[model samples]
Target: MSRLELAAARLAKALDDLETVVSPLAKARESAAVAETKIAALDAEREALVARVATLEDEARALSGLTEEVEDRLDGAIAEIRTALSR
Candidate 1:
């Protein structure tokens, strides 16, 4: 082959190699963007769950105080009956 023709062939081969290399890189970038979107959605869901947990905890605390008051009243009634019977 003439030197000019040989040089042209080499250039074509190099262009094919570059296309193959760049295509996968573009696909990888698209995949990364999709992954980031999913991560943001998951983070928002986690924050909502945390808020629900806090509300449940507050309700449980209020119920605990009510139980304590009921227990105290029962104990006092029992003590008063025992004292009257002993007198």
Candidate 2:
């Protein structure tokens, strides 16, 4: 083959080798972008869950207070009934 034709063939081979080396790197970058997006979505979900937990905790505390108030009223009513029955 002529020297010019040989040089062209070498250049084409070099380009093919370069493409082979770069293909995996490009795929790795795409995978990393997808992973980052998923992580961001998870972080947002975790924040929402934390807020929901705080709201539930506050409601539980209010219910606890109401339960104590109910118990006290029942105890007073029982004592009053006992006194009336004894008379």
Candidate 3:
């Protein structure tokens, strides 16, 4: 083959090789973008769940306090009934 034709053929092969390399890289970038978006969404969801858990903990503490107060009142009533019965 002529030298010019050979050079042109080599150039075409080089372009094809570059495309082969660049195509996968482009696809990888696209996949990474999608993964980043999903991660951001999951982070937001996790934050919301954390906030909800904090609120539930506060409510549980309040309920525990109320339960203690009721127990105290019930104990006092039971002691009074015992004294009356002993009289």
Candidate 4:
């Protein structure tokens, strides 16, 4: 072959070899990007769940306080009824 044709063939072969090496690296980079996106989504979900749990815990504490108040009133009423009956 002529020198120019030989040079072109060598350049083409080098490009093919480079592509073979770079193809897997490109795929690995894409997979890493996808994994990062999934991790971000999971983190957001976890934050929302943590906030919901905190709200539920606050509600539970308020309910406990209300329960105590109701019990105290009931006990006082029962004592008053017993005293009236004895009189």
Candidate 5:
């Protein structure tokens, strides 16, 4: 083969080798970018869930207070009925 042809063949092989080495690195970079986006979305979702849980906790506390008040009133009524019956 002529020297020019040998040079061209070497160049083509070098280009192929470079692509093989670089392809995985390129794919990894793309995957990392996607993972970062997903992590950001998950963080926002977690924040929303935390806020919702806080609101639910507050509502539950209010309901607990109301339940205690109702139980106290019921107990008092029961005591009054017992006293009247004993008479």
Candidate 6:
């Protein structure tokens, strides 16, 4: 073949090889975009769960304090009964 024709054939072969190499990268880019979207959704969900947990913890703390108050009152009544019996 002539030099010019040989150069054109080589150029075409290089282009085909480049396309083969780039096809997988294109798919990978698409997959990365989807992964990023999923990650954002997960982060939002995690934040909401954290807030809910905080609210539950606050409620539990308040209930615990109420329980302590009731116990203290019961202890006082028991002491009064014991003193009366001692008389």
> How many residue pairs clash in each candidate at the backbone level?
0, 0, 0, 0, 0, 0
Give TM-scores for every candidate, taking all chains together and pairing residue i with residue i.
Answer: 0.74, 0.82, 0.89, 0.70, 0.83, 0.77
Q: Which sequence of candidate numbers ranks them by TM-score, best first? A: 3, 5, 2, 6, 1, 4
What Cα-based lDDT does every candidate model obtain? 0.97, 1.00, 1.00, 1.00, 1.00, 1.00
lDDT (tens digit, per residue) of candidate 2 on 1-87:
999999999999999999999999999999999999999999999999999999999999999999999999999999999999999
Residue ranges of candidate 4 with Cα displaced over 4 Å: 1-13
After superposing candidate 2 on the true structure, give the runs of residues whose Cα lies further than 4 Å from its correct spot.
none
**Which runs in model 5 stand beyond 4 Å of their true positions?**
1-4
| Number of the top-ranking candidate, with TM-score as the measure | 3
Q: After superposition, how far is residue 80 of candidate 3 from its true place, in Å?
A: 1.5
Q: Which residue pairs show collisions in model 2?
A: none
lDDT of 5 by residue, 18-87 (tens): 9999999999999999999999999999999999999999999999999999999999999999999999
Model 4 pairs whose backbones collide: none
Two-way TM-score contest, 3 vs 6, winner: 3
Residue 45 local lDDT, model 1: 99
* TM-score attained by model 4: 0.70
Candidate 3: which stretches are off by over 4 Å?
none
Q: Per-residue lDDT for 7-49 in model 1, tens only?
A: 9999999999999999999999999999999999999999999
Give per-residue CA lDDT, model 3, range 34-78, as digits (tens): 999999999999999999999999999999999999999999999
Of candidate 1, the 10-residue stretch with the lowest lDDT total is: 66-75
